[model samples]
Target: MFELLKQPWHWAVSGTLIGLIVPLLLILGNKKFGISSSFRHICASCFPGNVKFFKYEWKKEIWNLFFVGGIIIGAFIATVFLTDPANSIRIAPDTAGILNSYGITDFSSLMPVQLFNWSNLFSIKGLVFFVIGGFLVGFGTRYAGGCTSGHSIMGLANLQKASLIATLFFMAGGFFSTNILIPLIFKYLQ
Candidate 1:
């Protein structure tokens, strides 16, 4: 069921709908909708006294929090109930080949995969790579003053110049890293 959602068109449609909703959110309440803000909301709930991280008048936006919860619940329902039976066969050749390279040769073998497989996920090699990758992502987000979607979708929609430059750099950086650096690094590791 979750496999059907791996489709490109499915993501494209969802992204377009999200973009549509951003304007509605702005018009209805003048809120710049984003995912990062949700983290802040959660933090405020856990540590209301901490002024550094949990610094928000989050109590006023309880309804917005409910909307976020709805999004999470809706995603679970879509994954479990709306997934197509032919999803495994509908997988892209590139994705299938990538999975095969990782020793996951069978599409049927992919499902019911373990989540906390620490030996594989937290191996010496895996952990170091994750630390470096996570650091780079955090650095990028900080250096840009916000995440890609926040600056690109919401910022550009409001005609913010900083966001435009950041969005272009983000796109260029993604293209170079994915098309060049990622393959080089993966080949060396293999």
Candidate 2:
């Protein structure tokens, strides 16, 4: 069982599990599912008197906070205990070659140390990528009414048209960032 837990499961396994979540949540009378809403719940619980947005009965969604907490704890356990260093960050040769062209040589960790390390956080590239990018993501998620997981998974499962539009834009934005923005950043900034 321990060895099985340590091994990587097939993509289908995760897909099936995620597929089941929609129906399970529906049966349980829960309409929403995502990490973003947990932030709202936390704010509502902590700052009930501060903002009109945070005046709701956050206790109703307390389970979502626990769910997000579990995700963080699980990630820590996976990275620190379960991960085999040799198999940490596997990339295809072509993908590695492409990244190498962008001055991203290190692939020893989940993300490129050249990009994600603490030292890079103080640099101009990191300021744009992390600080500004993070704000945009937060603003986008709020403006869109939900995050990618909420829209792509739960909202689409409920046949919401807005989710479909949001998902399409999300894909397009990802493509633009990967193909256009990232190369520009690497070429000019690095």
Candidate 3:
């Protein structure tokens, strides 16, 4: 059982489980499955500000907070207990080549130390990758009404047209970032 847990699960297995979540959430209490709204719930609960946006009854959505907490806890458990020290992350040869060109040869961990270390955090590349990228993601999430998981999974399952459009844009943006923006950032910033 332990050995089976250590090995990577096929996408079909994971996909099936994720697919079940929508129906489960609906049947359980008609709760919408989304992650991005949890941040707003947290802010509303903690700050209790006069902002019109945060003035709603966030308590009704308390389950979303628990869902996010479960995700964090599950991540911690997976990282600490399920990780196999001997198994290093494998990068595709094409991806390894592109990273090599950017002087990122280290693939020992999930994130290469070259890009993720403290020193780089203050550098141009790090500023673009972390600060600018984070801000854009936050803005995009709000503008899109929800995150990728929410739109691509729950929204699509519910046959929402807006979710379909948002998911299409998400895929396009990801493609553009990988093929164009990343190279430009690496070329200019690094």
Candidate order by lDDT, decreasing, is: 3, 2, 1
Q: 1 or 3: which has the higher lDDT? A: 3
- Shift in Å, residue 182, candidate 2: 1.2
Residue pair clashes in candidate 2: none
174, model 2: CA deviation in Å? 0.8
Top model by TM-score, which number? Answer: 3
Write candidate 3's Cα lDDT for 17-78 as tens digits. 88898888889999988988887787789996788878899999999989889999998898
TM-scores for all candidates: the values are 0.65, 0.86, 0.91
Which residue pairs does candidate 1 place in steric collision?
none
lDDT of 2 by residue, 130-154 (tens): 9988888877887788887899988
Candidate 1's error at 4, in angstroms? Answer: 12
Candidate 3 whole-model C-alpha lDDT, 0 to 1? 0.87
lDDT of candidate 1 over 68-128, digit per residue (tens): 7988999788666765545544568897686555455556523514322456466543554
Note the Cα lDDT for every prediction shown: 0.67, 0.83, 0.87
| lDDT for position 144 in model 2 | 83
